[model samples]
Every structure is written in structure tokens, then in C-alpha cells.
Target: MVRKIAAAAIAALFVPVVQAAGWEKLWTFEHGAGTSVAGQTSEILAFDSLNNELWVAGLKGVDILNAATGSFVQHIDTTAFGELNSVAIRNGVAAFAIAAPIKTDAGSVLTYDTTSRSFQQSYLVGALPDMVTFTADGRIMTANEGEPLARPGFATIEARGSISIIDTTKDSVTTLGFSGYDGTTGLGRIVSPGAKPSIDWEPEYIALSKDGQFAMVTLQEANAVAKIDLMSQQIVSVTSLGLKDHSLPGNELDTTDRDLPGNVSVAGNYRNAPVFGMYMPDTIASYASGGKTYYITANEGDSRNLEDFVNGEFNEEVRVGSSSYVLDPTAFPDAAALKATSNLGRLTVTTSGGDLDGDGDYDQIHVFGGRSFSILDENGNQVFDSGNQLEALLFADPALRALIDDGRSDNKGVEPEGVTVLELGDRTLAFIGFERTRQSVIAIYDVTNPTAATFVDFIVDADSLSPEGLSAYEFGGKYFLAVANEVSGTTSLFSITPVPEPETYAMLLAGLGLIGLAARRRRG
Candidate 1:
């Protein structure tokens, strides 16, 4: 406990904006900054295009702000409804997903007229609707997580994860569950010892298809994704996102939080290891490229320990070098030296699966996350993975070196949590938010080609921390990205300016040549 506290304290102590694009911080809004509810005012936000207002969801309620200036215009106290989870706006209407105080029970989607700030309609849905999104045609969808409340010596209430669809035109709701795969080996990754796949799979976020005919829900803990055919309201496929092989060259990672003598500067210890990481993505977004739909995910990992719950004591996580975990001598001939603290000893990994020969010893090591963002095909196959670049960039950048919590190196580096994409001219820019970093560190990538993507920049800001949600917009001839920081309870806006096109550069060179010729003529 003492070591854990000390580690937390140390972790707390810790942009290519000039190239492909330049960015500027426009304004920020603090939610309940001075009141008792300070630093607890936000989780998600949505922009009402028609009303030109941004609706922010927090514990207390919703805060309405001027999207143009980041000024608070009004507040709506929604405590009576329940715990607010997410907000989405479309046309002139806003939908708020509110989970019941007891999240295991049913939740509801409340719609409001953004123009009048008044309630319009309500539709009951599934439990713990963590994310709400709208199609361009006004179809509403929610990813109902249905998380379990666990305690020792007590019965756990396990609610099945589900997706809820609400048809605005029909004023009806349809909730879909994973009952068909409950008893089967359908959920690809880790599953709770005695829990069915239906209850074990928790939906974290939702991303819709371009044509509004399908939706993909992120089953984060399961390390899988479910494709829903919106036209049929059926879960067409559930694909396991597979694992990241750290043995590969570019997939290497910094494995420990070893600080120097004075703890004044954090040093990076990066290398390849005999391990694999489950791509348990928390957030995902879809885009169309070359007639193909590709999904981008921030590979944030998660683990659940049964010892911490009322379920059977089978912890999913254990230190790689722990006595309880054994490496098969046949697989790892040099296991002793590999167990060093600077090596894999201090690295935390999942223990649920790995015994290839059933000899009660692991032949492979599996960690929680990939520590990178991945671009996947419509079938959930990885087309491209960032691989070591996130950590490489962190150690490479002098400005971000101090912010690289060495404490997080042993676990998920930077902990890429939120993901959103924007269209800048001909380039598709992906912004990945790191939650575990000291402040706001957003990694931008140009993912024009699914097979080959390039890193654009790494943008950071002290005003934002632990960004839980991101929304990118283009209004008034400028592109802006809004970040909702959970820890700071602040919503920040940054305007993006892209680099000139090749044609523009050609024109400039031509004009410069003309000026040079005129100067020569004048000299003659």
C-alpha cells in the first residue's frame, strides 16, 4: 500500500503543429471550478450545430455552453433522472443517456429540444448506457456497458452488455443482447471464470457506419468488436481483435518504472520481450478509404480480478516474475535472467491464458493493451498498428520527456484512451488521447491509406488532463477539436490549421521565380 501510494504520487509529478498542420488553443470552459463539485463536472460533450451550443454531461447535470466562445450559457440540473453517462446532439435535438443510480438496472435516453432547452421525449433502454451517438439521419444508438458491482462475501449482480437503438421517427427503442453467445466460445479474448459471455462482454463505445446501415460497439474487456446491422437490428459478427506480438522489432516497449538516483529525470528502458498484448480498445471511430471502411482504435487495456470481486478468486493479472506465475522451461530456457526488474519482472500481465501445454506453466506472456492505436478493416483485422511509435515519440521528444510518467512504463505506456478522426482537406487525421500521461498528450496520425499511415504530431497542453472524450469540428472556416478532461473537469478547444497543398506550394514558387526575374531586369 505504501509503495502504491508513492507510485501514484510520482506518476502525478510527470506538436508537429508546424508541419502537416498548425494548431492553436482557442478557449476552455471550467465546470464547477470553485464549488464543491469542482473537478467533477464533465465526462462527455456534444455540439448542437443548429443551436450553436455545446452540451456537456457531468455528475450534477448538463452544462450548456456557447460553442463559438466556450462561455457557459446555462445549466440543467438532471440529478433526479440518474447518473449522466453521455450526450449526443443532432440537428436541433439532444439525447442524454442516464443510467439509473443502480447501474445494473435499466437506463433511459432523454431527448431535449436544444433550441428551447426543454425536454421533448424519453425512451427506456438497457443498463449503463456509457456512450450515445447519432447518425446523420437522426438515428440514436447507445452502448450499454452493464457493469457489475462486485464485493466480497456478497452476490454480484451481473447485467448483460447490450446495444440500444432508438428510432427518432418512430419514437421506439430496440435493445439487443449477446444471449446467443452466452454459453459458446464466441467472446474471443478473456472471459470471466463462471460468467457467460453475455455478461462478461461490456460495451464501452459506439461508432456508426457512413451509410447508417451498421454500427460497431467496442467490447473493450473482451478485446473484441461486434458489428451490428442497423438495417436488420442484428449483431452480424463478433470478431476478436487478436493480440500484439511484442517480440516483433517495432512492437517493443519500455517495460519498467525504474527511476534514477535523484528521480529528477525519467529514463526510458525500451526493448523487445517475449510477450503479447491484447488489443482491448476503449474507444473507436470508423472512416471510409478507397471504398473500404476502416476503424481506428486507441488500444487501451483493462483487467478484472476475481479476488477483488464476489466471484471465484482467479485473478486475471499477475507480475511476470512472480512466484505464482511460472514460465515453461522448454519455452524460456533463460527464465531466471529474464525475470530481472528492469526486464519483465515488474511488468503486469494477464494470467487467464498462456499455458500452451497445460503444464501449469505459461509458454507465452499476455499483457493488457497494445500501447498503440490500430487501424482495422471492416472485419476487425488489423491493417496497421502504431507499434512502439507512441513510446518512441515520447522518449524522442524533449518537451514530453518529463511528462512521460515512468511509473506507467511498467503498465500501459501513456494509456491511449480516447480516439477521434477528422477530415482536413484530403487527409484523414486521427487524434488519440492518452489518459495516463501527466497532461493532455494527443497523438495525431495521417491515416489516408489503411495499409500505410504516418505520424503527424504529438500535441500537449497543461490545461487538459485525462481526456475522456473528444469531438472534432469544422465551423466558421476553421477546424477545432474539443477535449473533455475528466480529472480537471475542463473542456478545451484547439483550432487546427493544415499545411498548404502541393498546388499552392507550386503557385508560390512560380510567383517567387517571377519576382526574382523582375529584380534581375531592374538591376540590368
Candidate 2:
């Protein structure tokens, strides 16, 4: 259903007047329907404008859809390869990354001829190729996360993360490893405790520049972004996104969901707290603004702790009573206040950076992932951060706020997991998907002015929960958005149409008035 907000409500929320750019939901397809089966988590999506088809990568296999009607056309069984992780289409060939049947650390890319709808070839790639994208120069790229499995009797082999660059023309694959670079040398690195830049850094997502000259890869676990020179086929630099101060005004976040005993509250009373936040981005996209190329990131944090350091070890709750967690008593005058309000329960003096008095205890604490998206320059310098803009807007509007509660506040608030940018009629729009919310929402932003992006509208659907992949395309003279919802095992389609400007409405009214006046004169 299309959600509408009154002008008064918009003004109260300090948002721009609701535009008429109608985002109408066309249809939704359930998981395991048509070629897809139940329990197959649809993770990634790619649109084939040439054939008017949509390609989806799920647990079972790849499902193809008619882009116009959202109907299933075919399902490509990937039983030979393993589970399907990601999909991409270019030059009329659909490509998918399939994990190996027995090996968890190895995968292959299966390419199919869209016209013939038959398998063409399969190329071997690294373990857990999570994301796939095509460059302007016919090069298919995949970000191999190389995350080790966390199960008993699992292989103890350390999986080194790398980027697989496939030359579609030559049908050759080149693996570029990030192990060579250490903070001591060429590029500055963001070093977290127990995280070896070479071993622990996992490449999550890849975003190519418009010209395809450079590729920005998000090292999600490292809280850093790596710049890759496509021509040189090497990582040029890895810049760390420093911690965000949660004590600031726009950076305030609700620290807890268990406010009063047993009941879980949906509404988060956000407050400015003393802590540092890591910007561990999950999904990233690049766009050009002010004649320069920039990248946008959805800071959805993730970490793996199977072997070494346990997860949540640095949390304030775990370290508060420990003698090792020394605090600068002067910095935190009221130690009890810090303990009560801290989101992580306890503050760690060992891992986090700040040491005011140089005496053992930490003056500040750090946490994972900025709960919003950010715009960064080519060198990985942050240009503009959404900060609490997303959270504030969601909290202010009753309709949208009700969709997500404070349950996720202590974690990744509204978890902006997926992002994509599309240019529509001189406007550059950014679509962001929230993963943790009850009712999934694709928040639309007018990102043409990257510095001053305005929240335009939201595409809400109860069935579209946990949107894992999103792509926007213009086909048959209309713009369409496709979302892969993992939780409900479905795919949803929506059409976006620009709302007419106020001047257009005024001109129409004036022309009608003049026509009425002319008719009366003629009758008299």
C-alpha cells in the first residue's frame, strides 16, 4: 500500500513537503514460487535490461524473472556448484557466484547465455564470493570475503580475502590479494586490536567508478575502505574510517532496548552518550558529485570471532568489573553515570585509543558500525555522514517509526545494509534498505546534492522484510526498482514516477482559469 503523510505531519518532522513522486508497488513473488523454492534465501539481484529479465541468486539456485510483470520465467539449478551467493548480468550473459559443494573456502562463477537460457561456462574463484559487479570495460569483478566457517571439525585453513577480476573478453581470472599491504609501508591502515590488516581484513562489497578507472572496496571488518587501481590491478591504498563520537548531538543513539524489565519497547529514547563508533560499512556504491567521484556506504557492521578474540569481549558490560579496564577518573567524573548510560554496558581501556592521564584506564570507549550511510571522497575521506538523520526521521513519523522499534538501537539501528544510486530526470536518487526492521523500507534520498541530501520518500512493504539486494533500472520508458527480501523469501517490484513541481501545478490552474473566463465571455 502507498503510505501518505499529511503536510502538517511533514512540517512537524522538519522534513520537506511530501512530493508526488508516486512509488507504487507492482507485485511480490514468494520464496519457492515458480522456479524458486521455500527456504531459499534470495540474497542478490541483477537486472538484464536487454532481455527484460531479472536475475536472482538464492540458496537453492538462480531464479530468472520477467522484469515487467515480476513473473518467474526460469530457475537455473546450481546443484553442481553449491549455494548461490551473488549474480550480475552484462553483454547478455548472466553471471553467478556459486560456493563449492564440499569446500567452504572455494567458489566458482557460472555464466549463462540469457538468450539461449543455457549454461555457458564456470570459472573458479575464491571462497565465499559475496558480491559481483561488471565494469564498464567488460570486466566482471567479485569480492571474495574468504570468511572461515564456524563449525566443529571445520577446516582450520586461514582464508585470505581477495578480489577476483575476470576479463570477460579473454575469459581469464586474476586474484588480487590485500595481504601485501601493511600500515608500515605504502598505504595507511586502520588497525584494530587483534586484527591483522593482511589476514583479518575481509572484502565485503565492491563499487566501481563511473569511468571504471578505480574500484573502492569496503573492508567491512577492518572499518576501512581500500582503493584499487583497475589499470594496475593492485590495491593503491587502504584508508581507515575513524571512530564517530556518539556524545555529539547528531550522533546520539538509543543505547538500550531493555529499559523496563521483561517488556521490549519499540520506541528508542535516543540520547547523546560518551562512546566512539566504528564505520564498518557493508554495501557501498559510487557516484560523481561536484565534478569528482565519491563513494556511498551503508555502515552495517559485522565481525567474525571463531578462533581468537571472542565477540562482545570489548563491551563495557564485560569489562566494567574487570581490573584491567582502567578508566581515567578525571575524564569520567561520575563513573556510575558512565556505567548506567553506556550502550555496550562496559568501557574497555585496553583496546580503544583514548588515554587522557596516561594511567591504565581508558578515557573513552569504542563500538561497532555507524548506524547510517556516508558519502566519502576518492581517498576514503568522509564528505558527509547521514548521522542520525535516518533514525530521527523514522522516529518522528508514527507510520514509519512503528515499522522498526528500539530493539535494534543497541545493535545497528535500522541497519542500512543495501544501497544503490540511480539518476532519474536530472535527479540522483539513493535507495537504502534497512535489514533489522519489522517492515522493510527502502528510504529514498535526493542525493544529487551529495552534501545536502534530502529524504524524499520511503517504499514500505510488510512482505519485503530484510531486503538483501536492490537494483534500479529504466526500462520501457519507466523506472523500476527490484528488491530481494531474504526473510520472507520473496522479491518485490516498484515503479517510481516523478512528482510534478509546484510551478507546473500553478501553470495548469492559471491556464484553466483563463479558459473558463474565455468561455463565459463567448457565451455572454
Scored by TM-score, the top model is 1
Residue 427 of candidate 1: its Cα lDDT?
80
Predictions: Cα RMSD each: 9.0, 7.8
Give per-residue lDDT, candidate 1, residue 267. 56
CA lDDT of every candidate: 0.78, 0.71
Clashes of each: 0, 11
Over the full model, what C-alpha lDDT does candidate 1 score relative to the true structure?
A: 0.78
List the lowest-lDDT window of 10 residues for candidate 1: 515-524
lDDT of 2: 0.71
Q: Which candidate comes out best when scored by lDDT? A: 1
Candidate 1 lDDT over 1-524, as tens digits, reads 00000011111111111135556777878889563244348778887778777788998888888888888888887788899989988878889999998888999999999999999998888999999999766889999998886657777677878999999899889999988886667456645766777778889898887767788888988999999998889999899988788887677787877534433324566677898998899999988898778899999998876567555755688888799889999899989967777677878987776776777999998888889999988877889988877766566555567777878887888889899988888888888998988887887777877777666666677887888888887887788788888887888888877766511111112321111000000000
Residue 141, model 1: lDDT of 93
> Candidate 1 — which residues are off by over 4 angstroms?
1-18, 35-39, 259-266, 306-314, 502-524
